[model samples]
Target chain A: MSCRPHWISPRWMISALSLCLLVLAVTALMLGPAALSVRQVCQACCHAVRGQAEYDPVTRIVLTTRLPRILLAMTVGAGLAMSGLAAQTLLRNSLASPYVIGVSNGAAVGAVAAMFLVGKWIPFGAVPVLSAASGLMVTATVFLFAQRGRNFGHSLLLTGIAISAFCSALTAGALYLAGERLQTLVFWLMGGLWQATWSDVLIMLPLMSICLIGMLLLAPAMNVALAGQRSARDLGVNVRRLQSLLLFFLAVTTAVAVSRTGVIGFVGLIVPHLLRLTIGADHRGLVPASALGGALLLLTADTIARTAAAPVEIPVGILTALVGAPTFLWMLQYRAGGRAGV
Target chain B: MILRAEGVRFGYHIDQPVLRGITLELCPGRVTALLGPNGCGKSTLLRCLNTSLRPQGGRILLDDRDVMAMAPREIARHIAVVPQDTPTDVPFTVRQMIMLGRYAHWDTWGQEIADDRCVIQRCLERMDITSLAGRLFSELSGGERQRVILARALAQQGTVLLLDEPTSHLDIAHQLEFYRMVRELATEGQAVLMVCHDIFVAPMFVDVAILMVDGNLLSCGSADKVLSEQNIAAAYGVRAQISRTGEASFQAQFK
Candidate 1:
């Protein structure tokens, strides 16, 4: 019955998470096959910024290779986490994530199809675009199907799950047709940050920023929405309009992230839930904290994937699932133990 | 504030109707209990008043203004609803849950300003849940949760408050306490309308009783006039005996 507020308020949580993300970004930039010290990384960055550094191997690796990958990781992680938070709130289900609505599978199908048609006629640059388009198409289908009922959130979750399964099957068939390119296709499906480029970062950054800002602005509506649809309407939330808006933004952000990262999983699901456990469910705090927490989790997992095997690099998705699944299970057990206040 | 519904008609299916041309008015500073058997459209009528369900054929007016033309937020600034048995999965603290009542008043960034915080604190104190402010809403018991929801509705600062089966799940003591709170709310100049099944207890606390049977209002008057033994038997289709327990209190025994 203690009425005292927690000492670590949401503002403090956000600040601490921001600090963690900054430290992780710096650490991620320092790790990789071609190791660079912190000083070397900073000098390379400054040199690149000033356009005065010689074309040294260290500078090239740090600037052209590692930096873009880290930025891509951060953006993709933040975007997916934001989308996941929206999905959870919209559906009123804790297990919901960015991929719950088939965005990742749709992107996978697009990327695999792009790989098939790449050498024939389609250019390589069209992969992310096609991926994003297909992801949106899938989302639209789910949205339309869910809109047919009064219980939109529940129907949406069910439709998304069914479509997600179907899309995965299509992706599998595309992989089967990709006989010669199986290894590369499987690598992409498993997901990695090694292929990130400055172009990927440029494309994803603005899109994620817009969606994230929009979601933050709509955070109060999202909080009211957690009171259930009837209560949401009573609280002056235009439930239908709010659901559509949130679903649209979630689809855009998830599609953009999946198109770039090629089907990374668990970052969305794990980050938001963990932040909810620590910071509570106010979307005002949950959105930004989830963004940073997701970035930290994915970047750390990517770092471990890169350094753990030295030469045979693990797909970052594999590492995240390996860690995330156990953590989620542990959390479920903890909550079941009655200490989680759930 | 006066909320009036004129010839409100609603139905789920094409042929069968849930609410049949119902008309009612709620005035400020009065506690009116909507009492009926199950599936009598008492809940539906409350929904129509709260704008959660739009009646197919009728118009609701708030202060003689068309309610249909008003924005959701504008309607929310006047009428607040407490729904029945709403279970949520989100792990929000009691304070955060109450703060959701201020959503219509929030600015674009939805920041909790000083006045919003003050309102929330006052609501918590009014609902006697200041000590439970830090507890998770999902962790509270049914009675505590009901009070929390009432606190949230109070925080909405609405003049007309509608509750759908507010004490349907509470113990006898909690049920009495809930009606006392409703009476307190009425005395504070808020109009209170509640859908209730406990015909025995409602007559003791509510100033007015609205008896509905099969989507029709059977009686609307003072509790003694509306909740008489014959009216209760007709509304519930059961024999009932009304015995006066005190000068102003009465209890019904079903035979």
Candidate 2:
């Protein structure tokens, strides 16, 4: 579809998205199970910053529980969206996502196995490392196998689907065998931020920061690459190297996010696609915009999951899919209508 | 710079060659039309010359240096290719698409500088697509998209421009406009080699015509000398009538 002349520029779009994210982040911290007011949240934040112990339950809940969860959601959301942007560009398929390419499932399998074998002994920190390794291996295998022909995008997607199915089956079998740990395994697989701590944020912040910066720095090459492999080559892009590097980073971002949050779907797919439609597909704008848009989306979704049922929290992943699937369908319909010259 | 392909050989399979011992030289300020029947090696040879496809046997030299030794970006600084079909799935605006041509000149992070923007503007004006600068590339008509692609190639500022069947999707008027742009580019000191299927239309715009059949060059000369009835029959397996319409134009009627 043609781009309508909206008064908003790319810079304006980024600023707006960042503002939305800020508002959403503050709201998420303020409204949770304990339901602290804005003043209490701000006061708690200030006291925590100044290293004072007020010893109030409201401040404790606000600083210790809600703040880490909010930060984790923001970081995971940004990481997934950036990964999805890279995946879509690298595969040249808008349908591609971190979950679609089997990396999330691979990480899920690794995280599940780590949960059974090492989650008790090595604690929560070791799961992401193990999952990142496994996810990287799976992504590399898919790349090697599907890189044979001219239509690599289609082939890569197909290979990823196959691997994803296999990984999902393995994860299911692990869940079945988990027995007493079934609730924990199922909770992780459905995706929740309940286990998030400052330690998890420590692991997520640096990894997501590196991957996000890498995606932005490589945005120009990725822009040229949208012209397809042959044109990208003629335009001076080393297509193979660019694809490899982008895919590597995509796997890393997806792996780290999934291992920490446990198989959150649709954030990676929906955020980039939605941002591309609204702002056009210039990766220079798309990457950062997707980052902000993604943080806003997941923050909003996780807040709803935390507050919608109140005493009972629905998994964030279910809410995202429920929202993302219909939006994705509408996107497909719009694209089809556009192609029909309507 | 002079682009010379010497004894180049290539094939999809080992035993069957698509291009066999092909040799040609393209000089600046000349427009050369490559004409051949379907399944001939015209497009293959063009790809080899541009370093998109590597020849197993010979060397392609640009200004007496081997192009294979150069990095892809280095080669791209001297050669630009307008592919048969441009990707429409990406939602890049026309101006942004044209700016992508400056990729070779960009530094490590590949940010577009002020000069790159100026070049993009110049190319857009040169191609007469300034009015469509804000339009999405996917939303443009076939002709507008083709011109935008040409503008991108011009923005590359390469000495050699290679086009593969550029008019396959254009109407007759757009095709004429396309070739006129090519002629203008060549006159401004770029070597233009285009694979064209229209025998009658190509002779009107190009300075030289190269005919290929069965992976061999059958004729390489002025259009009047190369599009003779005998050469057409031998290369295309058809009877043809050739008539000189003007000083630099000829009509070929195949029967």
Best by TM-score: 1
Model 1 per-residue lDDT tens digits across residues B1-255 = 999999999898869998889888889999988998899998888888867788798999999998988888888889999999777554678998999899888888997899999999999999899989888787788999999999998888999999999998899999999999999999999988988887777778888889998888999999889878788779878898888889668877778
- What is the per-residue lDDT of model 1 for residues A1-342, given as tens digits with 9 covering 90 to 100? 442323246789999989988888888888888777999888888888889656767788887888888888888888888888999898988789889988888888888888888979998888888988999999999999989977998899889989989999988898778788999889888888888899989988898888878889889999999988999999999989989999998899888788777788999888888777777788889888888888788888888988899888889999989999999888778755646433
Q: Please report the candidate that would top DockQ against the real structure.
A: 1
Each prediction's DockQ against the real complex: 0.62, 0.60
Residue A126 displacement in candidate 2 (angstroms): 4.0
lDDT at A196 for candidate 2? 86
With a 3 Å backbone cut-off (N, CA, C), the pairs that clash in candidate 2 are: none
- Model 1 misplacement above 4 A: A1-7, A53-57, A331-338
lDDT minimum window of 10 residues, candidate 1 chain A: A1-10
Per-model lDDT: 0.86, 0.86
Q: What's the true lDDT of residue A338 in model 2?
A: 53
List, residue by residue over B1-255, the lDDT tens digit for candidate 2.
Answer: 899999999998999999989999999999999999998988889889878888999999999999988888998899999998887865677898998899899987767789998999899999998889987787788999999999999989999999999999999999998899899999999999999998878778998899999999999999889988999999988998877878876776768
Candidate 2: residue A167 lDDT (0-100): 91
Candidate 2 segments exceeding 4 Å error: A1-7, A53-59, A118-125, A176-178, A326-342, B253-255
